[model samples]
Target: MDTRALSVFLSVAETLNFSRSSELLHMSVSAVSRTIQRLEEELGQSLLERDNRRVRLTGAGQEFRTYARHSLDEWQRLRRKLGSDEELAGEVSLYCSVTATYSVLAPILETFRATHPAVEINMHTGDQADGIARVLEGRDDIAVSGRPSQLPQRLRFLPLLESPLVFCAPSADCAVREMVQTVDVSRADFDWKLVPFIVPERGVTKDMLDTWFNNRGVRPRIYAQVAGHEAIVAMVSLGLGVGIAPRLVIEASGMADSISVIAAPRDLGPLTVGLCSLGQRLASPPVKSLWDVAEQTYPRAI
Candidate 1:
């Protein structure tokens, strides 16, 4: 079908007035009428019931309206997408938590940036659920997080690292010091039961903490609930509640003078961090290049 004539039919279908449709399309009214006639004849149907006084869609015109609108919208979207693909040569958005910067992920990202001088990498930090939502919605092409409990069908996860969940407390000769050294949360003097404790908002660390208690069937006494790994480390430094965090976080934290890492129990395993991305979306050359780099860097620590 002629695209120009199809456009005319669409405009006339919307306006239900040949003269108005012609004005909007910047075409002569006679040309608009001829286009509509061609469209109707092409489809072998009476598309418009019209005279000089009025115009209206016939059954065929009504049906064709849906297809016409859909086709024209798709064409416009395709044109816009080609323009966007050109712009994509410069930037790639990366989503991760603030704490990830302290781990291998940061080094990998630094290497990626160094190699791809033209590729502007934008980093967005947030909680894990928000990160998952961003990747699932196609907002961020890739996400670094604990593998979601239920991944969407359109996405795939690549396990990257397994970080042990450790118990940490102030090493100031407190009564709780023994409890941490033994890697025992069950002891009465752990102080975490009474003192301040920092926790993630709702990520792998929280799940690890919950599982630690649930597997033993003990209700943990909550002292405080704080957000962010840095904040937790700070709270612990201030002699607040104990903090349970990944080894990477506690190690990178400059406050070793204040808090000490407890030997994590053997029963409690490391949290699995991974990449979440849409399989089809990885088809872009740059996306695939970065994906390969991530897979190479991320798997070694797992």
Candidate 2:
């Protein structure tokens, strides 16, 4: 079992595209294919199902993926332990939304890079809501995420800052804006049922929104359920519907000029944005190095 082959297979399994894996690994597409083929031949099992349209992991591939992740983690851990005195050198995979790349991560990454120049940061940006799940699934070592109401026992959160959850409507003269304007949204008696609401599909913000609606006993007229706060802001900017999101995201979305914040009758508590990772993973030197740098950069109450 060559570690290099395992690395290539793991990359392909994660991306499910030979071309993508090749791009990430800096290998030629044919080389990546050869690596997977050799692994399949040696194991006597087809790890992937490939067609002209898509590539998917077979049942065996899924199982092998888990094994490969653990194997790679263990190998990295062993290397760090053996070279305890040497400067820490390895990769730490981080997941965050695009907004967080500049707003949340920029300063911390700057300080971390200055301290641990040898360590590599492999960042993947997407919906901030998926950050915690990605860390739990071993897809990333750490993620910038909002603290959930009920934190998972296996994970640890390091709070950096608080961003208020705000309800927003279109600033433009549109149907949605007109509906919002008809009622004084700051009052408890406001008719929420009449306003079409754009909501988060899932995540901490969604949980908070559900709680807010339940408390008011208002059955909202849902207009759409979208992923990512940036998308929520974009939709609301186009006068699609009223939406809920963190103020931090709304401000950074670049569409803030087109969106207007609504004064909710009740105070929806602020979201605690922070660094999240498995407790066990923090023991890894490279991951811990970055985590410590973040703690130092944002030294405040959790």
Candidate 3:
């Protein structure tokens, strides 16, 4: 089987758009279509379901995606092993939020690139909450993520820094801000149930927020359940509702000036931010090298 064809298939399988895949792979749309057609013909399977509206992966496509990833990893390993004893050279796929690219990964990537110039870093940015899932699914070799309460047995986490999970309100004069001002939030008797709250839809931050509210015996008035801390901050800045996010993310968000931190009666313990990867992936030189560089970059105890 041609590895190039597998690469093209994986690209299309991920983006689910021929035009986007072609742009990423630097191939023409027709060429990309032909490549997928050849792969389907060879395997006698319909890998993708395409219509004018959108493209979606078939069950076979999902399974083939997993297989293609492993095959590529093995092929890269073989090539490296057979090559001359030079610096490590291959691609390492990484996943993180847009903020993490500069706030968390900048220093580490700077150092890694300096040491391993030949290695390529393919980074994908999305909601920080999805980082762990992406790494576990083998969609990315590593991800910058908050440490989950229960670490998966197959994964390893390297603690880098800690950021307090903070509640924030809009700085602008709005109903939400007025409500916060009318009541002393630091008092134990404050009516949290009356305030509209923007919260994470899922992930560690959401879990922490749930525990915090439950422990306080207050069922929060949830206004919105959204993905990504950045979105939460943006909404809060517009005076939509009060929200919770890591202090690091709030500081990094350009709209920080528009958001005000709320002082709660009790603190939700700081969130530990770190690098996460499958234990097996760390065995790969490129992935391991980046992991090591990150550890050295943030050599502080969590």
TM-score of each: 0.62, 0.89, 0.89
Total residue pair clashes for candidate 2: 0
Candidate 1 lDDT over 115-197, as tens digits, reads 66665565667665466677765557688877655668998787888777777888776654544555566453444444445
Error of 2 at 283 (Å): 3.4
Please provide the root mean square deviation of candidate 2 (C-alpha atoms, Å): 2.4
Runs with alpha carbons beyond 4 Å of true place in candidate 1? 1-88, 173-183, 186-196, 299-301
The Cα local distance difference test for each model comes to 0.68, 0.87, 0.88
Q: What TM-score quantifies how close candidate 1 is to the native fold? A: 0.62
- Quote the lDDT for 150 in model 2: 94
Kindly list the per-residue Cα lDDT of model 3 for residues 134-179, writing each as its tens digit: 8887778899899989999999999999888888899999899999
lDDT: worst 10-residue window of model 1: 84-93
Q: Could you arrange the candidates by lDDT from highest to lowest?
A: 3, 2, 1
Off by over 4 Å in 3: 83-87, 264-267
What is the lDDT, from 0 to 100, of the residue 253 in candidate 2? 86
Candidate 1 residue pairs that clash: 196-241, 197-241
Off by over 4 Å in 2: 84-86, 264-266
